[model samples]
Target: MSEPTQSSPTRPPTPSALSSRSDRQFEILILALASVIVLVFVLSIYLLGSESWPALQRFGLEFFTQRTWNPVEGVFGAVAMITGTLVTSLVALAISVPLAIASALFVAEYAPKWLANPVGYLIELLAAVPSVVYGLWALFVIAPVLSRWEQGFFQDPARLALYTSCKNLWDSGSTTLQCFFVPSTFDGRGLALAIIILTVMILPYTASVARDVIRLVPQEQREAMYALGATKWEVISRAILPYARAGIMGGVILALGRALGETLAVAMVIGDSQDVLKSLFGGASTMASVIANQFGDAQEALHRSSVVTLGLTLFFLSVIVNYVARLIIARLTPKGIQ
Candidate 1:
């Protein structure tokens, strides 16, 4: 029995036992890397809040309600800028979402491989173009066409009379009537132009994300719908789109964030007016546009703080938008996936 006895074979280490010094070091490294983003985000908020405290103290809630922005007079408010930002972003979202979704559907479901690849690639490439380039293009190419149209519209006697009547109503304390007609002074380089440029600028973001998400819908979903005698459109609308709605929504929100934060392009074409929006074609300024246009020239401490406050407001606005988007996505996502 002693002669027959042998040493037992060695066993492999368990996963827990296999955690070596290198493994721990790698994990620590990953954790440190992940912490950097959070650190940066918190630091940004702190810096903005510190710099903007004076403005916040002085204006309180009035900063958002007041429309005046006079650096020389030491008065500043964000109502006009905030309105412009929201209007431009929302209008751009409304225009881009449908077009982007349609393009994504065409590329993902209808187009053959030969066509889909190129079209999808081109759409994705649009996002790579710089904002400055889009501004330059819009300023030189698109703005002139819009200006011509405006000139023609104003030249018509009937339209001119209608605008005059609206102006009379506006002067008679019917302030809301101003939305019905373009400002007589509008030269087309204002809210309408800004909306158009923002729409184009944000289109690629939604399209690319949607295309990828639509493609990811399971084959079984399509097959099941098809077996039930669904048409192609019906299958897509009922089966695939429902499954991919969460992802499509994510893309729409991403585009909206882009429209909200767009600076140089909007500043270049937004007409830079500091008044409340009076018409679709009237001059207006967004928060990002104001910050870009005024920060360097902000000589007074209050003025500088006000500019910083605008930046802070924009930061919070973006955070709120993303948080709302997350909630919506969570609610829309299938329970099984959640």
Candidate 2:
């Protein structure tokens, strides 16, 4: 049989065999770690629901659609807080996304090594700053700067004629709107401050992640673009942007979730007014802020359960928004493996 086929002993497990075994063990360990994390949130939801199932099921649809909150009477509606949360987050996104992407592009496309690294560090440092500090700065400094935008936008009789005629913040004129603008931090509350604080809070994470993604576009692709005589802007718009689109979008969704769940900074600046208003400058309260502020002092079963339900709502909203953002971006992407 061909000299017994020169039987060679199956060599003792090689390094590759050891490596594969080690990798499997490591993967199992990591999976255990990941599973432990999933357990916490799952358990939390179960416990929270366990505590409030009856209340959640009791009012049901009325609990959500009703637009009034009275703790003494136990008639709580989440409409205002929900609306405020959505509005403020949208405002933050509207303000920050373009700026964040632009900054990312600058760092990835234009800035030299010396400039990019230092500036990238500064952007990261912004994320490290405490939310309360951002709140304090926004209240003490930025609010006054932004408080002037109200009249400038709402003043035209023909433009925003739907908005009721109202004087500036100082006049104390009974306003359908909670805030009118004349540049004052004396009140220490306004949507302007909330938006600015949210923007600052989101900018670093969004921009930094985007910059990393943009950097991942291969250098050869850029060289080829230049060889084709594409202009700088044209190359970015065509090559870098399309390549990094998904990653940039992922960053944006994460940032949106951050803005939605943000509590302290928004709470500090939101003026915390319950009355819904017609203007962007109106004082507002977000769902997270309401939860953080009231969860401690909510002394009744009905009250506590209602707030918990609101918490669930906020959580679901974030989930849905991020999901939709991902889906939209995915659809826009060209068909290929990224």
Candidate 3:
């Protein structure tokens, strides 16, 4: 019976000894690099933690929420700076995202290739300039320009009506016979300046990445939507945005990371006030610029430690923001689909 049975066909060679061996080698190399990257991250966190742990222990969580930052009293609260950083970053993102996506869509879907490259380069060049230049530009050029413009916008009667109450309008026995005193010039330096400069800088990055995402969308997908009676805008809205949401969010994440760490530009434009306020026009410090401006001159050890702690705070906030962006994109991604 054994002799009668046909001999089994020869089996294939082990993958370990054949084409898959190269894959294994590449994977091992990638693992080694990944390990190094992880080690670097851990080491940086350890170093910062070691340096700032004393201040953290001394101040406890109170350091984060306190308003005052008195060095003589050893009192340090990051609340204002934290508020400034978050608010300005949010403003910049709000200003840039819609424009960036729109530009990307237009370039990828509507604009001629000849026009797109030059325009894209022009946008990208903004990020190439030094931050100090941006800061100077903001202070000298951008702030005054906005000061003039927003002075009118904020003073508009329409805005006054939109407000919950017109009661808050200037009412110092107004020189005018008007019932509601029109608002005057707002602070040109603080959030307005920071947001504008940040928007300019982040535009290149956000637009570039978004453009790439739109470009990656298959032509066939757009055509199929068109075949089903979709207009160009409809096709992009239904097909392109749905497919490229993750990529656009990734760009936003990248821009946010860049904006948060920005120092010189923010420092120059964000009027150096320690006070926190509900108004975006209120001047305040940010963690990066504060440390940059203070660390070298900080006389006391505790003061230096506090500045370092601010740096650590910035790092932590950045990581948290990045994680949140990832979670948002993940949630937005279509399940059981690419």
Regarding TM-score, does 1 or 3 come out ahead? Answer: 1
Q: Output the lDDT of residue 312, model 1.
A: 98
lDDT of each: 0.86, 0.76, 0.77
Q: Give one digit per residue, the lDDT tens place, for model 1 in 1-338.
A: 12234445674343453567668889999999999999999999999999999999999999999988888899988998999999999999999999999999999999999999999999988899998998888889988888888788888998788788877765674556545457635566888889999999999988987887788788899999999999999999999999898889988997887899999999998888786776777678999999999999889999999999999999998898777766765665543553
Taking the tens digit of each residue's C-alpha lDDT, what string does model 3 give over 1-338? Answer: 12434445784434455657877888999999889989988987998888888789889898898988888788888887888788778779989999989888777888798998877787778779999999998899878876776576656677756332423432232122242222232547776678888898888778887887788777799999999999888998999899988878888987898889999999887777665543355466788878877888899878888888898888888898778766765665444335
Put down candidate 2 lDDT per residue, 1-338, tens digits, no spaces. Answer: 12354556874444676778989999999999999989987987787776667566777787767777778988887787888888889889889999999999888789999999998899989989998888888877877655555556546776454443344422453444333442222353666678888988999878987897788788888888999999999899998899888888888887898899888888888887654443456566888888877789999988888778878887677778778767755664444536
Per-residue lDDT, model 2, residue 218, is 82
RMSD to native, candidate 2: 6.9
- Per-model TM-score, in order, reads 0.85, 0.75, 0.74
| TM-score between model 1 and native | 0.85
RMSD of 3: 9.0
The lowest-lDDT stretch of 10 consecutive residues in candidate 1 is 1-10
Tell how far residue 19 is off in model 1, in angstroms.
Answer: 11
